[model samples]
Target chain A: MASNLPVPVAESGDIDLVLRQVLQDVLGLSSERVAELDAESGLFGHLPELDSMAVAGLLTEIEDRLDILIEDDEVDGEMLETFGGLITFLSDKRSDA
Target chain B: MPMAALAGNWPNPPHADEYAVSFDSGRAVRLLIVPALFDEANKLRHFTVEVMRALDRAGIDAMLPDLPGTNESCEELAGQSLPSWHAAMEAAARHFRATHLLTMRGGAICAPTGLPCLRYAPVSGVKLLRTLLRAQVVSDREAGRDTSREQLLENGREDGLALAGYSLSPEMVRQLEDAELAAQDLPDIAQSELGGPGLWLRAEPDHDAAQTVALARIVAERLA
Candidate 1:
């Protein structure tokens, strides 16, 4: 685990880019589709592609890339409601880790 | 013959396998009963069987299904994504109308889909990934193999093996490496409603007290 690496304080734009990339890669969605994602989008209810398996798959990807651990209990749908919320949460987690 | 009792020799049996268990309601649940992953599975056979027998006596129908890419269920490990595995669990739950689901070690996440879940010595997928990556690094270093994180990811490009149990598809690997589960807010979605009561049973003197507490609190709050 790359736990020792200093967490990067990414700008909002950086967060947006990373979040979009993650969504694209994990959910098998295209950038064109993900580009329309806003801060208030519903991941499961809105996106037909985001099933339970996709959720788990997305979590695994995020953990590996961000070098953070997501306990099972932390996996609720609220954190994924909006793109901004997800980014903010990641930013906080990076700083904490 | 009924598949409820262990048929072979105890502990160091000639072979280990999963069988279907039936409930009084006449429902059946598929069980993926194998030894624990790595040496734990091998060493804990007696304890595992004892627990299974106890659960059986309690009238909880259970089965240890064959793992993907192993045993009679020769499903390709590459195709065994988390969703697929969950679906299998859901099928098992449906078969048994299981009110409670239990998993050991790496198989804990497989229990959360439908039934109320009870995890014994559960390990998170993220933690498992980190440990696997770290172990790969250490093993490569010791074995004098030129294995870098980049190489690991690259090898993952073809067919990446998770340290926990099964191998992941390239797409699955990339998805896992890039996405973060903790960042995703789940309570908002009605789907979080599906997570029934979750209880994490830990060994006495758990080293990760903070983590265990956090996990239990999170599950409790969400499922409440």
Candidate 2:
């Protein structure tokens, strides 16, 4: 079985900045939009543009932009249910990559 | 499997960038080839080819165009929408006046207008999203976090949250949250509409035969 380890936050804040940048670009939200977001902020409620089509589109965008492969079987709405959850998921995926 | 290979060897008339291929039935068929999501597209090449060959053998002409951003399609995936993709399929149908359309799994929605659709293990997009949410909840539970599947389902009703790798929007979440495959009450096409020689092939052993029968009945009804 694979070990489930919590991701480590960057002390230098560089990774955080990059992660946020990726989020902004992928979500097509302004920095101001992301500013109010927390780790738990609901992405769907907070961002109206994220429709089912957008969700699929966003997944494709993230895979392309991050150069990470997300299997269809591996994705779920909860993993992206909040900003924090999404960021955490990305962090883990990036580390693994 | 042998039949598929044999069909692949059959000579197909050459056409321009987007043209129709005809069979003895006289129905011009348009091909709407959809790529699988992300890495699965590459991994499932053999299976897709097999399916294409099967369709060809069945006398259903199809074109498996690579989706934008996946194979050779032009549009960046980020810029594409579900409606636009559907529209593209519609365009293919109109262009060909196709008699039938074939799709696999998620691509089942690719049927051209007025033509009967043949889906091999069709998966509803909304259902796919919900299943992903359920899996996440299961993952959380496996990680030692005490979580309930019901709570996870309820969470969709709360505020929309973006899953880590998935970038679900609030509206997307709501749509997925509220989506019920049963409620969609998809018409029974197999029994109603597809009586005139249609195929509904399901994977053996593990797949649900009852559901397959029900779906085939629906397709028959709709296409009959």
Candidate 3:
């Protein structure tokens, strides 16, 4: 007998898209604005909208959408420091999952 | 359109009057809108009102009621639990003579039984509590206080706790940790159908007219 569960796919491009969506949805950023964000674009402390409180919502939304769990200890300044950093963190989390 | 309070008479002593917003044109179809819980409630309020307005224009009546311990309700938030909320919603359904239920997010967990429920992004209560706890942790960290999620859970289960500005009773916290979305046969309005990401996940309260129109159209067509 085979399980009917869908296999989880870990794709960098998909992780990038997910992070963009989390930023846009959590911070209410426009699609065009989020699209312009590059790998080096600064996040935490840089974007006025991504305040400390919004970080909680952002991580929760990411965990829900990506089907991953983020331990409290894993959240820090580095993971959210740049656009690419979050994508990398999520990609790694998914690969681990 | 009228703003009023629904009287709750349950668990013995009657609960305080909870504020409610309704669009009534004396329509035959009545919908009781159970709002998202806590922070999600604030983020989706504008969208919820827009849906009610659209429903009114479509010749349907809709009501958005405040759960006890929330919004303008005279009851204390720290004293309200999930069971109390369920009772209040059941009373609201009765008071409004609702023919259907439109529950959003965490609201699905406390929706009254015996109605045709239409859910929009219904979520588990455990996830809601976790999000609140996570927010509290983030806030504490910003203030240079090192608090963990497990610590918060322990505190919440012991003497209750405050998260995201709302104080919770120990019972409420415990109940919420175990609450699950109940109705499975109901239809869900997916985010894709709404034309954008869920408004409830946004950092602040906002509205999307296209999403409102899409949601109201679905309700109108389904309930018709």
Q: Measured against the native two-chain assembly using Cα atoms, what DockQ does each of the candidate structures obtain, in the order listed?
A: 0.02, 0.02, 0.51
Q: lDDT of all the models against the reference?
A: 0.48, 0.47, 0.84
TM-score of chain B of 3: 0.92
Cα lDDT tens digits, model 3, B1-224, are 53332333322238656778887556689899999999889888888988888888788788888888888777899998998988889988888889999998889999999999999888999989998998898778778889999999999999999997989999999999999876477578777887888987777777789999999998888788
Error of 3 at B54 (Å): 0.3
Candidate 1 regions with alpha-carbon error over 4 angstroms: A1-97, B1-46, B157-166, B175-224
Model 2 misplacement above 4 A: A1-97, B1-45, B57-60, B69-78, B95-97, B109-112, B136-224
Better of 1 and 2 by lDDT: 1
**Tens digit per residue, CA lDDT, model 2, B1-224:** 22322121111122113222222233344344443443234434454554445445544445555443345444444444454555666665554455555555556543344555555445556655544554454456446565543565566446444342444444545554443323122332232232221121111112223443443344333434
Which model is ahead, 2 or 3, in terms of lDDT? 3
TM-score, every prediction: 0.43, 0.39, 0.90
What DockQ number belongs to candidate 2?
A: 0.02
Evaluated with DockQ, which candidate comes out highest?
A: 3
Candidate 3 colliding pairs, count: 0
lDDT: worst 10-residue window of model 3 chain B: B4-13
